[model samples]
Target chain A: MPNNRVVNKTKTVTDVMEEQTTVAPEATPAEEVIVDTAPAEMRYDTVDIDLTQSSETMLYSEVIDMGTSPDNYVGKIIKVHGQYMFFHDEMSENSYPTVVVLDATKCCATGLVFELEGDAGYPQEDQEFTVTGALDYPSSEDCPFPILKNAVITTE
Target chain B: MDKLAEYLQYPFVRYALIVGVLIALCSSLLGVPLVLKRFSFIGDGLSHVAFGAMCIATVLKLSNNMLLIMPVTIIGAVLILRTGTNTKIKGDAIIAMISVAALAFGYLIMNFSNTPNLAGDVCTTLFGSTSILTLSRADVWLCIIMSVLVLVIFVLFYHRIFAVTFDENFARATGMDTEKYNLLIAIITAVIIVLAMNLVGSLLISALIIFPAISAMRLFHNYFKVTVFSAIFAVICAFSGIIISILAGTPVGSTIVGVNVLAFAVCWSIGKLRGTAA
Candidate 1:
């Protein structure tokens, strides 16, 4: 009689286990774990300034050509070493950071404008610095050259 | 050193080395006969023709500029070589006329043809500012094929070339077709000139063709020894020049020519020392 009672208790326990397994999933409302799918800010810690290693005159020429055909360099992360200068527009009272690259002969020069994110301190006029950023063609009416967006500057 | 190793990994640098070495080899091979036959300036003339043709090609917006450049340069070579002796206009004079004319015409066309970055285009064309580094894969392959063809032709017809270079009239009297050999030389010269334009530009192509042979001649009298030495010297100079230019961020064509000039100077000094000792 004690053996029969033990068997009956065992059967009841198994039945309870099956009921829990079957109803547990349906009992919960199927909670959706929503994940944030927004893209992270594209930023680079270090950018290699290969222009210092490349042919200076040719690099200058290439940069000028890129200015003419902005479509070729859009979305490319570029690092170039050049003199840093700021142009203050009298009409708009806006100061723009420009990097001036001189050719090998130093007779010719080309300039590329850049935008910095944080307070990187104002670099001196004609200060040699390496700028790294993504190349962008701004839709601004006054800007004719391609720009470096979200730039990081380093002294050469 | 590490930077150079890294730079070499780039496809453009590899292409530059391949084309540069091949062009140097071909130019030096042809340089031997051209120097001996008093046709050293023909390289300059043909390169000028190539520059002019390139301008025309650019104006016409041709997909492949070599198509126009090759035929025009070949024709210029033929005219320069064929009419050299028969016409009142001497060879050097004709070459000068054509070279200057082509240069002037090319500049004029580029200036007025609405070509963007006119200065940059002219600078690259005239001085070869990284043109070797900017070559496409198709160009590199073409350069390789042409260089091999040039090498094979030089090796196969070495004896005939020597005879023609030494004495064309004697070669003709000896039942050899001197005109045919001259025509062959002209064609090869035109091709080399075209190929070399990327390495040293139109203004410096003559240096690429002349310096090695001249330096080799200073050290060796025999045609075979001179040709071999010229090829070696040209290759070394080209390699060193490219490396130095890359490291120093200097102009590639001028750097190669400067290396050639230095080699010539050293060879001249060595030749003088040997002459004095003897």
Candidate 2:
């Protein structure tokens, strides 16, 4: 029975080899094609800011701290699912979009401002959305909040 | 109504409602026995212990503060119950001592320690300022599981609890283990108080436990009726309080307690009117 099984395996391998030989030549050239250059800005689809399971309040706090600190979270991808908020700066007359993350108790909130890549219309205030972007600490006087640059927003 | 609907869309808000309701139910379940047994202040005492444990957990940067808080509170509960009978110091005095000490120590730790947002932390811990709205899904699950356990235990031992509460000497004389039941009550109360601290803060936990029981007592004569009414009243107050706090941007814990106070007032007035009519 073992010998018959081995023989059957060999026959299958041979059949596969024969089929591959016919297809290899056609597939080889296509497979050999290489990219000429890498893109300038690295695009990240999403970095899950999970708040549903595990220790979310602690994790959110850590994310807020990391985003605010002088450390280079710049260009690092982040995906946060949280409540959307907007701060209208009366002084600069500029509107800043922020995503607020609440702790387990909901008493404290950490607000993260994000800059959308294009002119995607801002979501309604206090709506929960999943936002993905590269972290940026803009030194501009008008807006000094930790921001997600080139962000994509989607309803949760 | 539109704004309420909008807020409900947020997962955190929904989570708060679930946890708040569960915590309210558990607290009210234990509240009846605690009030009847004259252990009303025990919830407040145990909550302070939990608060101290929370402060320590924070200082040590524990991932889940409940780990430290639960065991400490259970231990505190056991000690309080055990010492209630024989201690030279009265039970209320002992509870007050422990409660104040824990609060003071917790504050001291928060103040001297390198804990960030000390004022905010203290405020939230003591008054439950919007903490209910910040519940994670994990917290909701924990609250659900614990609340279920509490309810099951209460149901399973309902008669024993009633017997012990009304006439402990008679219960002990009738071959029932009064001490064991008392211990169980203390442990359950501690657990409920600890869970309730997140909803109403340490200072207001007694109100969470006491108000429902007392309000139900004002209207109901039978123990079962009172217990049922307390649970219903607690749930309604908790639900309404959470919604009001979310809409009005008030402190979640205090608002719930405020609702409880209002319920108590209404019950008191009803009882008075009924008494006069009778």
Candidate 3:
């Protein structure tokens, strides 16, 4: 695979923690190695852990409602599951990832695009986050998609 | 007489029908040149600009008068025209910038407001509820009058408008003030969009503008015929879409948009078949 690593100038505590664990891959099991980077004050409860077929473990958020639209949670939350229609995002390399529109309503958002705000020490495909962020409504004659203006991926 | 009596029995439904037909006619007429120019996205942009304006008004607890939306949207339209005319930065970039900025600003305004039910109203605006099914007779007359105004403008300006849209350079060389003409048309388009947004809501207004135009374009080659056919098509789709939504218990705006998309798809396929046959 090509190295498309993007450097972070403003590395958060989470980024620093992920970097530390990345070096000790051989000695520890995946769950024990992947520590939550949030300070204990900010860290919410660790509800449960589940591994998909690809063997990536996801920590569930108690507040993340998978049944609801995840657009508003762009900057505030992470790793939320929802019933977003499965469409091949023309812009992304990921073929089967769920697409969340800015409006949360399916019809209102046509083509808004987003990238996960931070790396979650896991594969991009496994790191599904429900984030709350600023939103941009469709304004131009050509732009069909509405976007969550600036999604800050806090936790997934 | 029976139709009139039926409407009298339910004033709101009658109002909705009459208002709906007038809007359908106006949208269909304006939609022809819009489709020809392939600027259908303007309708989408205009509706969103309207959304942003309403969001701000809601946040400020301003009188939810349609007039407040007008000034904001006119500024937005002017900005779009200015940025688009430069043609140095891709039009898409300007659109992207304005769209994101407008939406973000709208949200911030709404979030900070202390109004009662502000968020709920915002949601209603975004999804576009049709409580207009219960609009009073005066409101219906207002809508009808606006629609007529739009229709009359189109009729009067059809020649100059056609000249400008078909070939601006040619029109300019022929001593026509293309820039002035284009500006007037844009203003008209902006007003029409605002009216459409008021009647059907932002979510479905673009569908009303574009679907009939697309259907007519596929079926007819003459501009006049296309406009007439599209008006008829819009009325049918709008009326039927309302009926279908009422029957199916679905979101009215979404259902109408869905109907428009279906019409477009069917018409497109037929056009494809005809092309193959020829």
Which candidate achieves the best TM-score against the true structure?
1
Off-target runs (Cα >4 Å) in candidate 2 are A1-109, A114-156, B276-278
Residues B102-198, model 2: lDDT tens digits: 9889878877667546877887888876666556668879989999999999999999999999999999999999999999999999888888887
**Model 1 lDDT, residue B235, Cα:** 96
Ranking by DockQ: 1, 2, 3
Worst-scoring 10-residue span by lDDT in model 2 chain B: B3-12
lDDT of 3 at B192: 71
Alpha carbon lDDT of residue B234, candidate 3?
85
lDDT of 3 at B35: 67
- List candidate 1 stretches off by more than 4 Å: A1-43, A48-77, A83-129, A134-149, A153-156, B276-278
Question: Residue-wise lDDT of candidate 1 within A19-129, one digit each (tens)?
Answer: 333443233222221111111123454444345556674466557655755655788777787886665444543446688886554544577878654433324567677
The TM-scores, one per candidate, come to: 0.76, 0.69, 0.60
What tens digits encode model 2's per-residue C-alpha lDDT throughout A1-156?
Answer: 111111111223234324433443234232222111212122454453333222443335445554534363666777677786665545655556677776545656676777765434344557667677777788887677778877666663
Relative to the true structure, how large is the alpha-carbon lDDT of every model? 0.77, 0.75, 0.56
Q: How many Å off is the CA of A108 in candidate 2?
A: 4.6
Candidate rank order under TM-score = 1, 2, 3
**DockQ-based class of model 1:** incorrect
